[model samples]
Target: MVDELQDSVPLLVFLGVLSASYVDHVALRRHRRQILHLQVLEYYTRPGDLILFNGRAKVSALQRSLTRAEWDHVAIVVPSRDGGHLQLLEVTGDGVTLSPLTSRLLAYSTFHVRYFALRKLRTPLLSRAVVNDLLERFTAEVEGLSYGLSLRRLLHARQTEPALSRDSTFFCSELVAHAYKALGLISSSSEANDFWPGSFSPGDFVDAELGRHGASLSPEIIIDCKLLEVATATKRSPST
Candidate 1:
């Protein structure tokens, strides 16, 4: 059975891609609730939260299909350093950027914006000093880092739960994994974390399997996955 399933992986991936490609054609078909549900979410979420995104773009839809995951993108919530509001740190095609979460909602018209998981730690994996250290390191060195361009590496990876890598270059999941390893959130050896990047995709973080009682990672790391909207389906925009 295992062998048969392995052989079917390719067929499954193809079906996923084929299914996701139609998103753009029926983008307007999505039904949205009339009342905007923003104030509560904004008031509830604070800095250091993680957001798993189901982008409204054809590329995002394609990835969602490919990974068979509800979310295709992940970003870290960052409090504005200069004050006033919150922002997100993520590597899009434009590379790692700091932007307001509120602006993100306003920028898009698609209903996909409503589909995001506002994840946070049940208990902080690291101290404030450690968290600051990691943030500082990324800030100092994240410049010129580019979004990883290939899904092939993730697809062809060894059948390991937490895939590993050692490259300085960045992909969205790799970047988040790096943070997980650095803050001692993952149980593998620090050495192992270095090579653990490409093995796991974003879905692995939120997968049902990983939340088993004795699983290495914590379940509370994911706080809430609310599907709210910046705008209703009446307007369609796009994702990464």
Candidate 2:
């Protein structure tokens, strides 16, 4: 009986080690799978993709907002903008960069103001006094009223029925137009009117064109935008 018990002890020890080894292997695989999942998701980002986010939220807030699927695919970078903020960076499989916001505050303000105003005053009834006041304010805020007017027209096009037009080509073309206007590359509003179409499709790959062109680049980049969603559930408490 003693010899039998001694023989069984070695077998138990060997079984214990095998179980531990198996658990470790499983855990390692799960970890690796998660890492690979992230890689696969971020594989779709492209260069010059306009990344946008409010520069006032916590980095974690941004992270939580993202789907696990998007989170896995893109790289995340916190931008050191004036306010406490973080920016997401997505690296494409082909090594491109993209972001949500492509223009500065002045450009955005012009676009938004014109867009909102047009929506507010779509009818043919034009109150000259009101129109003059709006134009004055717009002129004071924006350097180029003509460009703002042109961009406003584009915004109108975007707002029209079958919104976004038949083709998404307008989206990229308008973006490039705004960027050039913001940079002062084109002198007159008419010159800026010339559209340069770009192929920017979601899930499409983009390379870091800005970097190649010697544009200022951010060091850290992330794959997806994270936004927060709160969920509430009612449940009965367990009785003691």
State which candidate has the highest lDDT. 1
Q: Cα lDDT for residue 24, model 2?
A: 23
List ranges where model 1 is wrong by over 4 Å. Answer: 1-36, 40-42, 109-114, 124-133, 158-167, 187-240
lDDT of 1: 0.48
**How do all models score by TM-score?**
0.56, 0.21
**Which one is best on TM-score?**
1
Q: Residues 49-138, candidate 1, lDDT per residue (tens digit)?
A: 566665677977776676665566776665565655776677778876777776674453245553544554332334544555665555
Candidate 1: 10-residue stretch with minimal lDDT: 16-25
What lDDT would candidate 2 get against the real structure?
Answer: 0.26
What does the lDDT read for residue 135 in candidate 1? 57
Per-residue lDDT over 97-168 for candidate 2, one digit per residue giving the tens place of the 0 to 100 score: 233322222233332211100000111233323433433332233222121223454333433222222232
Give the least accurate 10-residue stretch of model 2, judged by summed lDDT.
Answer: 114-123
